[model samples]
Target: MKVIKLDAIDSTNDFLKALASQDELDNFTVVTAENQTKGKGQMGSKWQSESGKNLIMSALVKDFLYNNEQVFNLSIVVSLAVIETLKSFDIPNLCIKWPNDIMSYNKKIGGILIENTLKSDGRIVSVVGLGLNVNQTNFTELPHASSLAVITGNTFDKDILPALIIEKIQEKIGLWETNSTDFWKQYFNTLFKKGIPMPFKNGAGQNFMGIIQGVSSIGKIQILLEDDSVSEFDIKEVQMLY
Candidate 1:
């Protein structure tokens, strides 16, 4: 997997797709930009990344192992990859929020966004994009936002960190694909909350108090609600809110 660094790009995902469309992108090829002018977030929200302060990169992946709704799990892989990478820095007290957000001290340090581009034959061509706040101090006033430097008090950020993170990503992806239980256990350990019952909302706006039972192979999360009943949801079907 060759990682391509750019001085600036509008969006790594867009760049990768343009290349993929021209048959230029290979699986595991990475495109990272110093700044993304039009970076996107969940639900078309603008991803606010100050220039040269965070990781704005996209990875090309051809995951044909998914069926129907399960295809979105690449974001999960990318999220877990980011979490593992941060841990390599010995950054303490970091946690993985439900779905795809990583946090430190209850504030989000970074996130993953995965987009799928298809071939004419219906094969899945995914561009997993990560916007992890790395070397930065202040950001536009957002409560759930932070950076690696801000969290770990490190003076340096992206220069030496991206390579380390890429290595961790490869390791995590391999482990997650082979041993699902081990992946779940390790992911659960870094969860913001696991055993304790907490209030959560789903996509339908219904609320429930439940324990996050971690991720399932189906990519749905198991929620053991206060009623002693268990329910499962895919991605945005459940949103954990404190």
Candidate 2:
């Protein structure tokens, strides 16, 4: 991993993406910031963090060679990596909220934002941006957000956590080339709210209760509604209601 440590920046993902546009970056090339002025999240949301107190990093995933259909698997890999890293720190009740939110005890502790570069035929080269709440213990406005320090009652070395997560991510990238069956199985097993009934809101803003089944290979969520009918949804099609 070629690591670039920045004191402050607008966004690590944007920085790495700009570098990738200029030239081919090595696989696992990383850019991390102590402070991000405008940190981005999925669906154009903002990721909030206290300066120098969390993990704000982006990694280059070159030559992944996955088609558009398999893009979500990349998300699965990154999310699982964060989960695995936190578990080693003994964070309790770790779970992955669908479409890449990492949660513990029903509160979000981490999230992933992935940007992709597609070839002429539409295969991908990914930029995986990760934000994990590490030592920060204050989240006054973010009612559902928590951190490793908050959950465990112990302050952690923020710098060390990112390196550990990157190492785990590298292991998952090795699986991308072959035998992804095990990774997929682990993903489903760690999925949050799996087999539980919960309220959800669809794209139309309609609300209903549904049981979490499993996600499809391409990343569509499968849910069994109250009427015993099955429905599959893309990320934008539905959202889990807390």
Q: Go through the candidates in order and give each one's C-alpha lDDT.
A: 0.76, 0.89
lDDT of 2 by residue, 44-156 (tens): 89999999899899999866656778788888888888888888889999998887899999999999999998867665878899999998988999999999889999998
Give the least accurate 10-residue stretch of model 1, judged by summed lDDT.
63-72
Model 2 lDDT, full chain set? 0.89
Q: Worst 10-residue stretch by lDDT in candidate 2?
A: 62-71
C-alpha RMSD by candidate, in order: 2.5, 1.4
- Pairs of residues at least 3 apart in sequence or in different chains that clash in candidate 1: none
Per-residue alpha-carbon lDDT of model 1 for 150-218, expressed as tens digits?
877885657666667667666766776676566666666877887878888889898878997766766
Candidate 2 stretches greater than 4 Å from native: 120-123
Candidate 1: RMSD to truth: 2.5
